[model samples]
Target chain A: MKTSEDKLNEALRSALKRKFDDFGDQPNPSSYDLIRARLKQPRNYKYLLLTIALIAFFVAGVMIDQHWITTKSDVLSTKTGIKSVMQKAANLDINQAATTKNQLEENDSVKQSVSEPRTIVSSTSTKISMSSVVPALSPATLPTEQTNIVDAPEILEQAEIAALPVQISSISALQPESFKTTGLNLPAITITEALKSEPAIHTNSQKISWLLNLASLKTYQILTVPKSGDRNFQNFKFPSTFALESLGYKVSIGAEKNGFQMMLHYSTFRQRYSYEIAGDEYVVQAVGQADYKIVRPGTIMNEDNKFELLGIGLSKEVQWGGSPPRRSPQRRSPVRRSPLRQYYASAGVQYSHTLNAGPDIGWINAGFGRQFAINRTVLLNVGPYAEFSPLRLSGKGDPFFYQPYRVGISLGMKLVRP
Target chain B: MKFFTSNKYKDLTQLVRACQKHDPAAQTVFYDRYKSKLTGVCLRYAKTRAEADDIFQEAFIRIFNHINDLKEPEAADSWVKVTVIRTAINYYHRTTKEQELHSSLDYTELQLDSGDYEKMMDQLNVEELLSMINELPDKYRTVINLHLIDGYTHVEIGEMLTMSVATARSQFMRGRNMLLKKLEKKGIVHHENF
Candidate 1:
């Protein structure tokens, strides 16, 4: 009943099984040992990836901090100098009160009532209506305001006050014995101390206020030719180019409420475009070994012209991190410290117009960064960011074209105000 | 063929369980047990002893690495053999540089008598038969080995080789005829039957 094909298959299978089933040959005895050795060896790729991650983190930290680019606002010496100027102004005001008393009584606009003793809360802009008259403080011969409201300190400029001669004396003239009877419980604060205290008081009232953040970006442009059937465009190579002109800058003015910042921004950057030809059909020769090469007769091209762009956008911030603790409304703390740190991510769309002769483009942008508090009112930030654009930028009558996208690091400062 | 049918089967199961945990001593025993059988497989698939050794070692490494994936320890024998065969195929596919040349060969005109082929296979020794199989083109040799000696169905061979079942069957026929021609050239079978 068996056919020749079945018989042939049976014969082959029977012979193969008989030969190979119990077949044994001596292999290199070291094969198992080699396997053991290989298994024992640590995986180098995991370590390599870890090392690369650490190096990248270190480099990004260095780039973000930029310790070499320290601002005057960050220096202790500048703060000390400002404190000294304020101290001298306070001493001058206390010392000159007696000398200027006769001149103060002659001005009809100024009224002094010595009978009813009350707290003297005086400033150039504000006058407290009390049972006793409070004299308005002027830059020439007047004591500064003793109290700082939710608004900033209404004090004379330190430069104007520090220009006068100062004497070391008790500030009892500004804080009279009668001030204690008024029961306001206000401390005898000097102009120097008031300047130090005003920021905390002002920030407490500035929950939802306007914030202006300025940013500078070092842009890297990505260029690609549009997919087309044309052979010339397909064979073109776009090598990346970078220079000082590649640095883009942005200014965002927005308001933040409950950690959400909605901003309208204006950004600007310049692009310098260039490309090279590559194909098997055309013989290629480099022109000075640059990005471009000569492929056809009179087809040599090299462009290093500036294309300045002015862009405007609207963005909203998404912040996620620990925030500063809130203060009770009824109980005010005399001093408030800055929060440890904060982080934010933002996304938006932008439309740009070229200041030079070029095509206008639109971009969708996103960025994330860590914020370092410089003070209660100002924060410094640095982060990696990217922008994507779909518009094609091409030369008129040129066969080659490219769509552009940009990636960059944005360094900026946020200034908060009521 | 039936192998490890009784107490040896229990030992193989225990050995596989130990190997799954990557016990070094058990791995050595497992290696020693399967080495000869898998080597026989590699030798048939490879052209030379050195290539066979390479495939055998790579196959064993894969067997040890993936042993933990074998849910039923009883299937270790078949699993190991399948791993060895697949490793050998992958090794040959990676190293074969003349694939285009082999694919361009004409297999349509090989007219041979199956009766003569069947008669010749009985006289041929295992070494001679293996040599004839090795002499065939890579595609044909692999298809013949997978379908005939390995007891794989044409559908299984097609899936393994990434070809249609029709192609696998046609390739086996051509390879069988080529082997018969070699036997005829050696005077072991007469060509007049064709």
Candidate 2:
């Protein structure tokens, strides 16, 4: 049973053990120090990169702020150049004081009273009057026999128009300024026609006014809803939209043609809606028609919201003589009792691309607008506008009154295209 | 498996704790205790003594770094052995080589009984046998040394070297036959010696 090969292998194993019996090793003592010094714990390198990026962003923001302030000073310097140009133009009117006897006699209704029969040298007055047109035509210049009492400002406005190149057909638009404490002077619609004709007057005021009106304009708007149950609301009973619970902002840009304008606006706000749960307020954010997030007390859960409105509108000065024609007071219904002081009411059809509960972006904004003239070149428009998205016409007592609305305030500055 | 490993590693608690705390004195004791055994393991997979040294250093560094994460002090011996073995295998993979892992041996499917191998060992020179192992090809040397000298199972050898158990068994048997042939040619033949 003991093969010769087996016996040899047995002997070989014994010899191998005997050979390595004294085998040993001694590593250098310095190696331990080397391993210990370079010990590394596992770490996520991504987080380190992210932190570095955030610090870089913070530094860049500081640099941008410093540059922005420097640029703002440059804007001020440009504003100074404009003021100087206005002064130079005022000093150089081509035709001065053309008040002939026939010119005075023909316009018998709007006669200017000269204090004495002596020949008055108007050259001295003309130089002073040309500098500040508004200041020159005081109420004392109006004829005493003109029956309609008018504000001194309106008289000055008439005088300013008199200084323009075109001849106004009637001056009756200046009469209602005194008798009626507050209403738009209807005949001032003449100004829109005057602006449309492109008169050949290269006066500085006309040039500035034309440049302001020539192009599509952009405006910033602060969208707001009335505060809930405040004194302003009790008196006016405007639509209450304060329950939405956040600030809103809007931006609009568009072209104006013949006192009719169409603008595209994008607005952002916090859309909040609430319900009653167990006799307590359960505020919820409406992310979509079917999607909502429940809110607990002390939870700040206001998410940003955006909507687009394409509004086509027509504006006109208010009529003063008779009762305003009841051509269906359509625009006023939406903005009826808003407490804001408004002028020049306008009607417009607006297509809203709000986070729609029903159709995707519909003709939901049927509303009103109030355009206030800030200067000859700029205007501010603020009014309550209601979206028909939530309206149910079948409801009682004019469902229109129940519709909540947001206020859009747009600042329009004149632009000239090349 | 981690819990079982932790439970068994309890035996090495004092040594492991010292390594975890980075105690240089205890670390010296720990490293010295296993260095020779692990170096022997490293040498079997390495082509030369320099390669063996590199493998040994890398394995120990890994052992110390993760020593704190090992919960069972008693299993440290098995864990360190596996680490050194893995390090050697990894080193072989990382290096470029033309060496064949398994050499073809003669057809001999016979296995010797315990007494038969004992008699064979008694007749052979042990130094000559180890030197002949170094001369063996890469995979044959690895399989034979891991199986016979280290007393590892075929399954354990396959796991360490990333081979199937059957491949490990085949390489081992072939390595054994080749070693016997080499010894026979060196005039340490079975019947001739007897």
Candidate 3:
């Protein structure tokens, strides 16, 4: 005869087993299902998720602040001073330079600020111009100063401000994201962002200004490249979709004004992909995509895969937001654009040649971004952008190939060259 | 309002997938599948029936919240149990007052003879045995259930309970000793076994 102990143990195991599988659960039923349902509404979940995300963002901001602000170095002090120099430069009316030196001696703040010519030049002349100022000038401020520069050949301390390199270095040291490059130490810069970085230089009537952008980007492409003139191979398909990475800088020197501005910008985007030509359906080629002609389907092999793009773009910016230039209303001066508005949108027509080799492709691109003053010197720029281009890639025997559009985003910091 | 029917999932993987998607019926099924065992786990750690209920509810909530973080769906049973244990510990920490120095305890090992509990098993039910477990101090019960029933090593128990491995082992031994004495006093285990 079996002991009741055996039955008790058996009952416990039986009670714990899940109805469908042997997974354990007691015989007791619970109202947890009903209660959890009441508690787990989608709206509640969304709110909870939103709250958590907000907390995370707050924590991240705090962390970034702590990390960036706590570090003390000569580099930091220079970056800190870049903003003051920009602020003062924008309001400078260097035409007053002859009189400002006299005031500098009387004003303790200005006198205290005095230092050796070399240290002041290296420090105040930021590599990147601070683009923070609204650039809004009363007719009496910048316009009058421009008229006086000719009268007084003793341009005073205006000669102390080194124009282009200072803007580049200052912006590079402050933030590398804005203009994406040409601002601080960046080699490539957005045209409008460059405008903001060195408005101090534009305080004069210059036709051309330097722009740089610094950024790292990666993208992928999938297309069927058509073979040339070989009508039989024209329909050949290569469903080549792979990944590529790029780390490059762009540089632009643009002609500027208060109404309309255009820039000739160039960039080199590099890509890396895996190429295995196992069949005609999947043809692998070099990094710079070279057109392939296939006579047979499923008859190719994979070997080398790498592509470099040398891209050139003609970008345009219209300062429609600027207050119509008061005195130059009929002329539509670019200065009419709201001098206070530091944000702008840009569009461009671009061409890319694969690594000084491969097919030349064209793209039309547009983007919108904003610059916020982080401090007197640093400006944070972030934006979303899209680029459209033709997918003229094809190989032999590929009957079905899909070409998808490409889009990307960029973030950077620039010096607020007031 | 019910959004799904509990019996729809075919397997643990399917159930876990449904839960990850926040499928109402799948979650109900998951709850039905694990609640009883998890409640049993809660009983070992909580100081009272109300506390056990609270721990079970909190543990299930946590499990659902982090279901996607579980690396292996097949290991859901062990993972759920571990989560409940941690939740119970957390509940203890949250509800209890400030902790003081844990005075050293000198409890001898408990030895059983002649199958008294086996005989008592015929008379006393599982709920009664659970109640007997509940009689132990909260710390001891947690240590005992985690080490013996849940099969957590002393190091694991210590880490879970925020104590040293030796402390976890000692608490388990002391809890076991105290539980056996209670069983003897209640005649569930014969007094002569000591």
lDDT of 1 by residue, A298-348 (tens): 233554445567666665554434346543232222222233336666666
Candidate 3 shows a clash count of 74
What does the lDDT come to for candidate 3?
Answer: 0.49
Displacement of the residue A382 alpha carbon in candidate 2, Å = 57
lDDT by residue for model 1 (B122-193), tens = 565667767777787777778778877788998998899888998888777777666656766754343354
Global lDDT of each candidate: 0.56, 0.45, 0.49
Model 1: residues with Cα > 4 Å off, grouped in runs? A1-3, A40-418, B1-10, B99-122, B187-194
Report, for all candidates in order, the number of backbone clashes. Answer: 0, 36, 74
lDDT of each residue in A239-357, candidate 3, tens digit only: 34433333343444344442234444455544332222222242334455665332223323322234455666676532112223332222111232223234545566777666655
- What are the DockQ scores of the candidates, in order? 0.24, 0.13, 0.07
Off by over 4 Å in 2: A1-23, A27-418, B1-11, B21-26, B96-104, B108-127, B185-194
lDDT, residue A344, candidate 1: 61
**Tens-digit per-residue lDDT, B36-128, candidate 2:** 667766765566655666677778888887888788887888899888877776766777476664444656544554455545555655445
Q: Candidate 1 has what TM-score?
A: 0.37
Model 2 chain A poorest ten-residue lDDT run? A330-339
TM-score of each: 0.37, 0.33, 0.34
